[model samples]
Target: MERFTPTRYTLTCVASGREFEDEGWTLDDPECGEPSLVRARYAERQLNVRDDAYGIYRFCDWLPIRRTLRGSHAPVTYKSRKLAEYLGLENLYITFSGYFPEVGARMTTCSFKETEAYNVCARRAEGEERVLVVASAGNTARAFAKVCSDNRIPLLLSVPEDNIGALWFEEPLDPCVKLIAPCCGGDYFDAIHLSNLALSSPRCYAEGGAKNVARRDGMGTTVLSAATAIGEIPDYYFQAVGSGTGAIAAWEANLRLIEDGRFGNKLMRLMVSQNAPFTPMYDAWRAGSREMLPYDADQARADAEAIDAKVLSNRKPPYSLHGGLYDALVATDGDVLVATNEEAREARRLFEELEGVDIYSAAGVALATLIRAVREGRVERDKIVMLNVTGGGEERFRRERGNRVWNLRPHRVFPLDADKEQVVRAVEELFA
Candidate 1:
């Protein structure tokens, strides 16, 4: 008889077609000399949701982590009654990842980014000395801060100063997690640059945004949860993406579920959306170009500033990378859509009124796109559809626990154009 084995997933380079073991945080195979997203190939070929495991760890068979973290919860997937009826759909399921406790969502950060933070941070070596560095628009920062703080993992976060308001937490973070921001009016890209510059310090390591298999596979758990609840793959999957990492994760999960042979072997059409005025992916997809069209930096910043959902303002996404969002969309016959602020606000209101929970603006953007798809006849009424509510319950969470929730204050702020030496020195001071 064969022995049971867990945590036996290998990393596969999409570009080089080579498989290798995971060495902590290897985002790409440098030997291949090509930039590509590496995928996790699990040893377990069959779908096995561990009954003993809690939260995201239930899908531990497919995740690329050796251990699970505390306070981690999986996305709550349920067939919608009100939202589905209101949309006049026979099969609409909602995979919600947020703080709607009534429906079993306990993501304290009120975002699915917790999925990334828990898996990514857990992937670190047991005795790693290097400080994990993360760059975020807002939600990612809060998610990482919360997980790293709870587990006492040394972490440094960089976020745009304007979006710092999103760093609210259930309680004050521990000292192990520190935050910094770009002072001179920057966007998510600027936050990435600041964190990248901080990487000059030997003590710092990059979180590897869209390149990290841990992050993608963690986010992929949403689809895993949905598939488990639905008993099969859906006809369409919808999400709002800034970097399109979540959508790519869904695609990867779809492939894995198909391979498992228990779930229906069908590719769900990924209906991803971006907030209007900052819709780079939508523009590129509509133009039928694999290469993203050039949007001037100044104009992108202007557009980013104009959007209500600030998290969806990523100027550069993973669409053009090998085995990235572009490849995933093409393989799934997906389409990118856009939603205006007015449309998104209305969508949020509609969803909250019908579904009995408030959702984030990014989630609103996703629902808005679905609304457009249905009205335009892009999606059939009888088709099975899964809507990924990436974040929500902030209004409820705040209303219930506002007095106890604390803000994660910045440890330091640097000029947007600060050189590497200056940034590294400031970071060194934090650990000193």
Candidate 2:
């Protein structure tokens, strides 16, 4: 594991809309477009603290539990030239933290969840009987599995069975982490429901996801890393999002850097992309609305569920909060893109051909969004730009004997109305 550090600090409320403290850090509060001024300087690592307690998110260095990239999982090299040409920006850079090995960007979980999982558990209470419970569609589960295995920490992960085997790599099962695959045909929403129940168990503590400052700050490391590699923050930031967590993370990280007196506090124009059928935020943004309709939620979520990377889609996003995602987009003049699967596939191919690496579907969507931004002239070509590729490069992973699945289907399927005792007995049998 890499040594993580903190450069500055601040606090915000998920339930409320207020800045609690800066503690020596600068702030770039974005609601749409670029921040007018920056309190901090540029090109340095910083930590963004949303909540005062729980987890700390360092912007630059991201350590993933006990996993190493020496033999099996090499490293991904960071390259910014190709991305610069695509966005037509002078100092544009691409943050490679997935499967690409040229720059040693080996993120074991493949997904960005590695940012959250390793950071959270690494600083947790040591030797405590901790039962960490999480809800995921796929990527987060894989990240948790890798973390638990590497760190030897006990974890309870719940996910839809359909998404279970689809996770990119099959890591060896760690006895401490139990993978609960939903019995009934379901999606991420169902997984969240089951995760809620698992967290309620006496022995476990739910990873307060959205409210967990560590997860968001951890995910923000990509931005810090990107800016660090490029020597400054970009004018435009782009990515594929489900819950908009990564975008939120990037916004928060830049805000912290602005306060630290090291980075310019310009709120990069965020461009978040999603699969067309499941693009609730994209649809809502296109319809000229800040809030999402319930009907839109159902359609977007279902559409996201219809895809191979269903885990990337989050129904309830951080946009609901003031100065949140919706607030950031509106403030920074951000844009959203919804691409059809066909478009995503084409985008992926184009990117692979030009960049010379296969990308995951989520990355494809993000690339598509970047394309839209470039064509519309939404991005300022002369300024700096950064694109976050969430995941990719499966064909490169075939070298390792990496295919395994611990089939821990829920002990028993339960109805929504299933009595507590019945649920208790079914779970108790695992202990028995």
Candidate 3:
């Protein structure tokens, strides 16, 4: 596969309809004034970056560059005729990336995390000068480890201690990639704290977290890849969002296509789903502001701390950035759905019955949300739709592991209230 090496970045201002160089940051004074977005564009398209001063860069505008390094876990599906006829849309396609024998399964997830790895690593300074710090739960660590190890990019991943078990990859993570699960019991947000500290190190670079263009752009390939397979992008975009990085990526991809004069900017209404137990975004959307409710974050964190899927819940979502995902929702008149545990299971069963596939829990939320949208009349039956099955490799995969799992744990731990200097000492132990 061919990879792009661009010399400069592109800057765009959505509200103003003018684009310029992203010498640094761009501000948006929303006439709406409360909780509006001001975005920073890096290139003509999405670009994933790892710069010392920038923390993360050009990730949004250049997110599309991410699709290059990933392998598929599912197929571009058009077999949902029942769904298609029901949606009342002309073209309906399913972007499936899971573990079924048909789709290639990587070690970490039934869904394709490979898409994230591909884009994150593709746009980097040549000669291996960059270091990426990934904050994940289990699956993302495993996925990123596979990608960084394959690309020989150094990655320092911080995951919650309990979530470590799911870090198993189809193959052993490459030695160059560092794994850092918390030594104590907390949650995904706790792990993110560690990653934030790691990023402050001169030797380490953050994956841009939710802001990384690579993650959002690369993940959007599920949409683009499906669109190419189906001959058109859908009028509605459906996905289960923890961080909602993928939905943002999809919106950005559709924007780029419009800029390329190929696809219309009439994006599919982004129908996003979240686990009901962790529906901060849902609550915020319901209340009519993009602001995060402090009580919801505290409550959700405390509740999810007891479980392993906490990584799927991000307290701070990137919804209000200029041209960010929240903006996408407003522009498309999108709606948010919260999936109950029962609904997720039912959706999973329904999917397995109709599509002959078992999806990840997150994907189940998406499928369930889509069903809810359909049943509740939020989704017009005649509109074109696209559903992104982010991952499902765990249930559908048939591949034998090429390697064995390793007994791993956090490299070190702080007091959870440890200062920066203490964290710095911990990060230095992994240095080459």
lDDT tens string, model 1, 244-291?
A: 999999999999999999999999999999998998989999899989
- lDDT of each prediction vs. the true structure? 0.90, 0.63, 0.63
Q: List the candidates' TM-scores in order.
A: 0.97, 0.80, 0.82
lDDT, candidate 3, equals 0.63
- Write down the worst ten-residue block by lDDT for model 1: 1-10
Q: For model 3, state the Cα shift of residue 27 in Å.
A: 14
Give one digit per residue, the lDDT tens place, for model 2 in 342-404. 877888888787787777888888878777777887766776767788776555554443533
Q: Tell me the tens digit of each residue's lDDT in model 3 across 1-432.
A: 223344345544455655554332223332434443333344454323232222112233344232234332223445366555544545556777656555432324554566676556765544556567888767777777776777677888887777777666555556688776566555677788878887778888667655555566567667666555555567888888877777777776776666545554567778988887777778878888866666544576665663223556776677665666677788778878878777887777777776666777777788878876777777777677788877765644434453444545566655566677777667877765
- Could you give me the TM-score of model 2 versus the true structure? 0.80
Which one wins by TM-score: 2 or 3? Answer: 3
Against the true structure, candidate 1 reaches a TM-score of 0.97
Q: Cα-based RMSD of the predictions, in order?
A: 2.0, 6.8, 6.0
Deviation (Å) of 117 in candidate 2: 0.6
Ranking by lDDT: 1, 3, 2
Candidate 1 lDDT for residue 66: 61
